[model samples]
Each structure stands twice: as structure tokens, then as C-alpha cells.
Target chain A: EAGVVQSPRYKIIEKKQPVAFWCNPISGHNTLYWYLQNLGQGPELLIRYENEEAVDDSQLPKDRFSAERLKGVDSTLKIQPAELGDSAVYLCASSPRASGGASDTQYFGPGTRLTVL
Target chain B: AQSVAQPEDQVNVAEGNPLTVKCTYSVSGNPYLFWYVQYPNRGLQFLLKYITGDNLVKGSYGFEAEFNKSQTSFHLKKPSALVSDSALYFCAVSPVYGNNRLAFGKGNQVVVIP
Candidate 1:
């Protein structure tokens, strides 16, 4: 089985520009997550989706960041008016189950590295 | 709020020697601990997890972690290090009863010398 897939492995944009990242989860996976990883830091949860419903998005920056999983299989994260501080890696992960049990090991995709100048 | 701590920034070990990476976590209730490895320009790969059963949990790539409730620590270990084992290792935690949000620690870079 193929692992989670993400598009545009590297992106460069100027400040105040808009940027978007896309993700495709593994087959039959019911849960998807978006995380942000700053340099020398671990990945932090930005949003989580169970099927088409976003179950957890409390950490997402609503003022500039937005995400959607319309079909529940693929997801897109958009950042409008990107700032210099927004430069980092955006990762997408998926799991087979939604119960969040120990068996639900999340598989991650090669993240998209965004550089905002 | 759950948090994880990986004390060391980097660990160097010779091939055929034992490898260890330290991690500690803080959570409200029972914790679900996990370990992951990331290679250069690659995604994080699942190693293993500890939920309820055993204190020692074995994971992929010949790695294992010991979950200590008393110390609130889950440290990853490998019996014999290999050159290919050089990578960034991360420790994560989530509360068993709360939302399944994973809190990750700053990753530890493991360098295996040949």
C-alpha cells in the first residue's frame, strides 16, 4: 500500500502572497491530520479530520490559515497573505482508524517546505 | 495539555554499539506514547507505541522503547546500531481520554558511526 502523498515538496513565495498545499491520504484511512514543523522543532498539530468532518482545529490560525477535506480522501491547506514567519514545513498524516487507539499508527507524507521571503 | 521532551539534541554511537534516545512526557491521565524516525527529505515513519499492556514495546527497524510511568519517560533503544540507523527520531504523546491530539518533542538526531 502506498503511503500518504503530498504535492509540491518545495514552495517559495514572497510575503503577502497566497500559498496552498495538498495531501492525499492512504487508501481506506479514515483520519487525516495537518501539522506544521518549524526548524529545529517537532511537528505541531494544526488540524485533524475524521472523514469529511474536521474534528480538531483549535490550533489552526483562522485569520490566515484554512483547510478543507471535501471528499474525505484528499485535503488542502491554504495560507493567505503569507508572512515571513509562515516559512516552515507543512506535513500531512493519515491513519486507518478514527478511534485514536494505540493501533492507529499514523503514516506521514513527505512534507511541503514553504519559504516566505 | 500534553507535552513531550527529548533532552538530547544529538546522540552519536558506533556501529555494533547500543543506541539510546531519551524522552519524557507530561499528560493528565494514562498516556499513549509513540516513536517515529525521519530520514533526510523523508516523512516521519512510525516506530512503535505504548498504550496499556507492556512496559517494553518493540517497533520497526529493530527499535524498542520502555515506558516508565513513575518517571513519565519513554526512551527509545536499539541493541546494535547500524550506519543506516542515522536519522532524526521523535517522541510523541497523547492523553488516553482526551482528544487524539499528538504532542511531539524536539527530535533527536542519531548518528551511527561505521
Candidate 2:
């Protein structure tokens, strides 16, 4: 089966511009996650979705960042008025968690590299 | 709060020799640990995980990790290193189940010289 897929592998935008990244999780997977990865650092969770419902988004910057997992299959992460600090790689991941077990390993996509000027 | 720490920024090992990458973690209750590898400009690939049972857990690409509850460490190891094994390795931890927000360390760069 194909792994997680994401679009716009790279994005370049000016400060205050709007930027968006898209993701499509593996078929039949019930959970999806969006992560922001700064240079030389590990990914930090921005939002998580179980089906179409966002179960966790405590870390998301709601002031200008928003996400939507429509139909529980595809997801979009958007940032309005992007700042220079927002320039980073956005990673999307998914996993099959019918049992919600910790053994379920998350599979990741290539990720979208966004650069804000 | 849960957190992971990778003491080394880089680990160099001669090909065909054993290699080890160290990781330490702190979490509340039982700990669920994971190791992931990433190539340049690519996403992370799951290497292994420790949920329960044996402390020694084997995973993809000849990688393995030992869960030391006493020391709060889950170090990744390989019996014989290969050039293809060179990559950035991340150690992550989750305090409980169904919480996908795994606290990850900065990462360890592994270099295997042929």
C-alpha cells in the first residue's frame, strides 16, 4: 500500500502572505497528524485528527494557523499572514489505530518545505 | 510533561562495525518509546518501538533498541553498520495511549563510513 502523500513539496512566500499545504493519508487509516519541523529539530505536533474530528490541537497557533481534515481522508494546513518564523517543513503522518494501541507506528510523508521571506 | 533527549549530535562508525546511538527520556506512568530515521529532505521512517514485554526490541533495517526503565533510556543499536544506515535518527516518547503528540529529541546524525 502507498504511504502518506503530501503536496507542494516546497513553498516560497513573503511575510504576511497566505500559504497552504495538503495531505492525503493512507487508505483505511483512521488517524492523521500535522507537524511543524524547524531546521535541525524534530517534528512538533500542530494538530491531530481522528476521522474528521480534531482530537488535539493544543499546540496549534490559532491566531493565523488553521487546519481541516475533510471527509477524514484528505487534510489541509493553512497559515494566514505567514511570518518568517513560520518558515519550516510541514510534515503529515497517518496510522491505522483501530485498537488505538501504542504499537501502531505512524507513517510519514515527504513533507512540505515552506520558506517565508 | 514527557520529553526525549539525544546526547550526541552525531555518531560515526566504520562500516561492518557495531554502532550505537544513545537516547534518554522522561515521562509519567508507563513510557512508549519510538525510533525513526530520515533521509535528506525526506520524511521520517519508523525504525522501532517499545511498548511492553521484552526490553530488547528489534526493528527495520537491522536496528534495535533496548528499553531501560531504570535508566529511562532507549538506545538504538545495530550489530553491523552499513553506509545506507547513515541518516538522522530521532527518539520519541509518549506517556500514554491514543495521544499522538510524541515528544521527540533534536536527533542524532549517524555516519557510516565504508
Best by TM-score: 1
lDDT of 1 by residue, B1-114 (tens): 999999999999999999999999999999999999999888899999998898999989899999999999999999999999999999999998887889999999999999
**Angstrom error at residue B80, model 1:** 0.6
lDDT of 1 at A91: 97
Q: Write one digit per residue (lDDT tens) for candidate 1, span A4-116.
A: 99999999999999999999999999999999999999999999999999999999999999999999899999999899999999999999887654347889999999999
Fnat: each model in turn: 0.71, 0.75
Leading candidate by lDDT:
1
Give me the displacement of residue A76 in model 2, in angstroms.
0.2
Over the stretch B1-114, how does candidate 2's per-residue lDDT look in tens digits? 789999999999999999999999988888899999999999999999998999999999889999999999999999999999999999999876546468889999999999
Which residues of candidate 1, in runs, are more than 4 Å off? Answer: A99-103
lDDT of 1 at B16: 96
For candidate 1, the docking band is medium
Which is the leading candidate under DockQ?
2
